[model samples]
Target: MKTNPGQLSQLLKKSLAPVYLISGDEPLLVQECCDQVRKAAKEAGFHDRLTFHADHQLDWNAVADEFSAMSLFAEKRRIEIHLPTGKLGDGRAVLERVLQEPPEDIILLLISTRLDAAETRRKWYKELQGKGVHVPVWPVDADKFQGWLQQRASSRGLSLTRGALAIMSERLEGNLLAASQELDRLALLANGNTIDEETVEQAVQDSSRFSGFELVTELISGRAPHACKMISVLQQEGENPLGLLAVLSRDLNLLLELKSAGGQAENPASFLKKRGVFQPQRARAMEQAARRLNRAQLHEAVALCSQIDRATKGFDPLSPWHYLRDMSALLATRA
Candidate 1:
């Protein structure tokens, strides 16, 4: 059956599946799930483990051979297969065939960043649900994220105020990897005391100011100068251009969603919290932006962002700063 990231530990404690198919777009949750599986396997005395990458072309026979061969060193073995790009073809056939006459002392863990579609899930995923575990790692919402942050702080024997949590959540923007890193930094910086809002603000700087939520806010507010300055700062700090484009694309999509939802205010924070927008500042910024930027302008901004994204990813060696400057100028213009 489909399981969430939070319930993974309890599941592992109760049952050990012969095969685990872990899939999701959220890298942090996906990785955490994989870690849990590995840790559980190790604890259960499956010390000998093998890892394979799906992206690297290998003979299917080799994988079959590896599964067939018994480990000389350990009584049980765990094999981890990472499909980073999710190019694993008709794994159902191989898996079904193997599962029919399963190996006695081997467990297989298939980790992927992309989940099968609903149809695929109905077909292969459903079959595996009963026999093996199918864990879907979804992005944590903002409200849940606050609890996670508090738990993380408390685990380190530290405390955080509500305002500090809000600021940290805002700075991290529901990116759990970034949030976790920032929290770790804060834990170290605080050194066994409650972390205050000022300390959190001082700890985490807006690294990519002209991207993601910040970019959306600046463009919406008609603050071209601030956007330009942010772009320069990001460039000087060696931020990747294509990376910036991806962030812009995501932000534009969110703006479109807000625009489509209309002036009802519908709690963008709550909506985005489910999609992993944990920070209060970001939620407020988007709320303000929704009021200011019209649908047409938002659409145009999205188009510009997509074009810039493609250009940056292409072989054209032009300066990314120039493209960013031009985009800023275009965004500055009144609709």
Candidate 2:
């Protein structure tokens, strides 16, 4: 049974599905849906809850064994299987058994990142969807984001003026986690007063909206001061270091490829255009940014990014965000 995020609450009110598959790229929404299912299961006599992190190469046996094993503590158990990659891998066989012969008195809640169409076409995936409640959460559209902000504020006992809600939507940059946290902050600070633009302005001055695209644009254009400022704002806004690194790494790889291949073409910008640099403004920005650094400096910047990646993965002692700030400064420097 397919379900939209909005219909999840209503679905939970009915008899719970044996398997609940919640998929979304947004971490907050995915977790929220899982929470709803777990809450319903708890109320329906699922007294014990177990959690498993099934990253790409997870041990399927452990999870399968848990599902098949008899419960010791509680008569009914709820098992949460979190698969970040959304790929069943070797675990597909185990999932087949669980779906074909679900545990007699257990609820299986599966949380995964977004799945591509090709992945979704797999027989196992299709079976899971057919057998369970499949909830796919799409991102909120830009025009409707302000409405979401207003709704979120209302839930927190906030009476936000349109102007204030718009301000919050802009500052939050469509990050639900950030928006939720900011709302928590405002609820305490507002002290029963309505939230106005003036209040939001004062509250989010140091922690303004920080988009990865904008941050990379600033650094690529050699605006070191602006890039550094944005980093501070991003940190204050509770941006994830891993996500920031992903954007920077992608842009750096493109720069590296362009630098290596630019010599073959008469016009570097035109060459970049063939590779999806469609917008004139963005093409010009990349071209200008290319002139600011030599191949060696660009290579070094990529190396720094790799180090930041390692730092983020717990292979280094340095903070990933701190290294990312330093890397931005390095990239912004003229060769």
Candidate 3:
């Protein structure tokens, strides 16, 4: 059945499903759910758990043979199939047949980076849901991030100050892996004491080169030299061009929203606060960009960003870094 994330623990307590289809873009949540399932299976005496990485070349017959094999001890068996790309390939036929008549005494877990497509969902996914459990672990948004942080801190016997939590949340940008790593680091440094904002600020450097607010500060303040330098540094640091494009797109889209709102507030933070831009740094950046750039210029910058993104995906001749540099120069120019 389709299960919500909140209900997963309760579901796990009652009975383990014959098959679990856990799919989402959130790496931490997905892994956590899988870990939970594995732990529960282990507790139920499922010691012979096997793992398979599904790929385009996966052998369906071999997989079937393994699943259908009788356990030496006749105990419960667990099988985890991790499909990172979520493409089942030619194995769909075998999988469908198995799903029609699932093997007894074996718990099958299917993990994917994201949910199957609508068609796949209707076919294999629907069948699994009817016979077993389908859980979708979505990414944690900003509102839910605080609870996650607090729980993480509490688990480590570390108390995090409100200010520190806010800063940590901002720095991690809702990425649980980064947030978890930072929490671990903070726990180590604090030695079970309370972590304050100053500690976080001192420990964490602003490593994000493609941060929209930072880029806006560079462009609006007429720091073309700095903007160019930052772009080069980011590329050298192996930052993904597509990721940078996403940041730019998000910022430009917010700017467009603010422009449409038709406000000339002296403190743009208040205006942005009303518009759901809660991060203080992001609000400040938006304010700066709003003051310096006109609507037309913002639209042009967004278009250029989209073009660079498309070109990076092999639609043009220029390399992603070169395209980014050119776009940065164009953005630096006053329209």
Candidate 4:
């Protein structure tokens, strides 16, 4: 009942699962898996598709009725429930009821964000996995990102030379979405030719614009100007403010973790390696930021993040972008 993307593709060719729980933090991988399931279901005659956004106010009764009702034209249906927060809430009870007498003509597809360890232990989650498939996509880390890029290029009928691969992996960093788009662009530009460093240098524009991860790097290196530039580009690209906040928040918390552990006294590379900061550049940046900012400054930066959130939701008079700029200055400025 548990499968990866490769196995899932092969499995789809043989048979479609009656239910699928596709959850992940990586949007590209999650979307791809869902697309595979959708394609398979359509081929298997699940022509009628209905989508519902699961939230606190979701009408579980309506979903229950739809599950029990036969299609007027006798068409197989796929019901997709998207839970962004990954909490079923009251929907768990309704799903349990429906799964007890699993409907043959209806396929249930639950797409969610990352599920923590606790969520997987719930009875409803286990029951769904017992009856169907659970595909949990994990983010490709820095060590594996180049290999992932190479594989993606091969799939697109383009082969990347070693130097080309190095340029792309460094330019794109760990952002999968950017890497994917760059590969698509390369596929067109190569025109059946192998992508060498010269070809890549000519064809691939820097794809790091889509990376929210870079904002953290910029801030830590005491480059407010660069960080501010990233914020402007991200805003122009319609990047989600909350998503950006999540990125900054995560790194700040990690900095706090290091500070708590006497990071200044310890060697950074070894300290970060123990905590899974595999990328040397990132670990160095984190260490610099930790040593540069005192505890009070770090705490104030975190508080400013909260104000940004409040401002975003209209709880504060200031604009979220305004708060973001202030936080950028706070972290990037030398104390």
Candidate 5:
């Protein structure tokens, strides 16, 4: 059955499903679903567990092989597969055969990126949903993020002032894992679950220093020097290179999108609406980024970001910070 993340706990409480396809990009939500499944499986006497990560050139036959092997050892076994690439390919046929009559002692848990509508509508997928649970999670967007953070904080015994919560929300920027970790940190420091703006500022250094959004704005508005300076300042202030790079990549993606949408650049509001970007501030930033940079320059920015990505992964010889600083300058001035 198709289920939302909120319904997962209750669903698991009643009975464990034979097969589950939990898909989403949000790490916390996906992890939560998997945790619920794991807990339920363990409680239900499903001891033996096997895990697989699907990559290019993976032997699709391994699915059947592992399931069978796990079942041989344990009466109740679970097989978990991670397909971040979303390339089901020939594996779908294998999965279909495996799940044709969902095994009584085996539970198949498939984790993957968000499946598009077309993929979910496939015969094998529909049958899988029929036999088990299909849980999907969406990110806590900007509009609902603050409230979610507040609730999360409250659960952790941290009572943050509205101003403090706002600062935390912006600093973490909808990252649930980071938000959860920061809440733990705040709770440890909390005298009586109460936190003030200053305490928050101290907890997350540079909460007020330089924002990711401000960096985007400076770059998109063609303030090369300011963008470069902000990059340096933010870097020194302990901003995450990956997070900053993510924001910059988003900016380039938006610009590339606008460039592809011919004649839409003149009407920013309409374009933003068409693109489903609701946040007015972000919409404005994207529109401005699209307007300021041309197609070629935006592509160059994307290439620069790719280099930074490689550096972040230790694939490049240069420091990611160095690549980021160069990217900031390029976006601000040229690309």
Candidate 6:
């Protein structure tokens, strides 16, 4: 009745459940599970898909009416209810009524944001889980991310070295979408199916005039002019803003961590060594960035990165490049 993202594919192979309740905050993982269910449903001859957004403005009466009605397009239907806020609200009673005796002709797919423990205890969720399958997707955390990456790479028929994994885990951690994209790119460009650190670096370097790491270096080194130029170049080159943000986010987070760890008190090299920043040049650059920027500034820059992310995704009005330039100026500012 209950499963995880990894097991969903196997479960789908067994048989398609009448109901699939997928809840998660991680977009990629959640989408992957949803895709599996849709594919399986289609294969099982459930072709006509109807989607309803369970927002406050939604007419629950219409949703309920649609459930009871026969599909004019196809005999079997796949009904998807998307609950962005993870709350059914008025739809709670409607869902309960619909599921009381779900039509054999329809497959119900309920997708939502991460459901809190309280939400999990709700009658609708309990009923969905009991009746069919509930796949709760969780974010791949720092400790487990590398393992996830290795498995993903293997699935794509790519071999990754330890160093390659480390660099990837450093740059792509906490962002599965970017990680997946990078791996997909590697699958095409990789030579002889083997991906080492150099391969990864080359991939990043080839993307633009300045790679994400180089942009970070410019920002942290307080080279406002060069950093701004790099951002401009990256924008002109049509680089995905998300990729640039990924690298910036990682470095800003590390600087914040070092600041929190009392990194300023110890020798820069020693502190960096303890933190696994072995490269002398990178160590020196991070050390200087840490000293020049305060915790408050780093926090501001981090927040700005979030804004850039939203803008890039069309959630915000301004262009992502605007936020990118602003973030560069903020980080390039001396404490």
Error of 1 at 78 (Å): 1.5
> Quick one: ranking by TM-score, best first?
4, 5, 2, 6, 1, 3
* Model 4 lDDT, residue 148, Cα: 89
Candidate 3, residues 222-333, lDDT tens digits: the string is 4678878887777777655554454455566567667766655545666667655786766776766666678888766765664565466575587777876766676666
lDDT of 2 by residue, 1-335 (tens): 89998899998887788899898656567767888888899899997888776644457898889988888864899888766545667777888888887886899888775653566777777777777899997656556778888888888899988888777877675466667778899999999999899998888643433576577677777787888898887778666665545445545556766777776846877777766566576677788877778878876775566566557657669877788778777877787
Each prediction's total of clashing residue pairs, residues at least 3 apart in sequence or on different chains, is 3, 0, 0, 0, 0, 0
lDDT of 6 by residue, 199-290 (tens): 89878434431366677777777888988888788788777776556556656767877887773567657766765566677778898898
What TM-score quantifies how close candidate 1 is to the native fold? 0.64
User: Global CA lDDT of candidate 3, please?
Assistant: 0.70
What is candidate 1's local distance difference test score?
A: 0.68
Which should have the higher lDDT, number 1 or number 4?
4
Residue 176 local lDDT, model 6: 74
Which parts of model 2 are misplaced by more than 4 Å?
A: 205-208, 211-335
Q: What is the model-wide C-alpha lDDT for candidate 2?
A: 0.74
Location of the lowest summed lDDT over 10 successive residues in candidate 4:
238-247
| Candidate achieving the largest TM-score | 4
What is candidate 4's lDDT per residue for 190-246, written digit by digit as tens?
889889999888877663634666786787677888888887877786655654565
lDDT of 6 at 229: 89
Least well predicted 10-residue stretch by lDDT in candidate 1: 115-124
Pick by lDDT: 2 or 3, better one: 2
Task: State the displacement of the C-alpha of residue 272, model 4, in Å, after optimal TM-score superposition.
Answer: 5.6
Judged by lDDT relative to the true structure, which candidate is superior, 1 or 5? 5
User: How well does candidate 1 match the true structure, expressed as C-alpha RMSD?
Assistant: 8.1
Of models 3 and 4, which has the larger TM-score? 4
TM-score of 6: 0.66
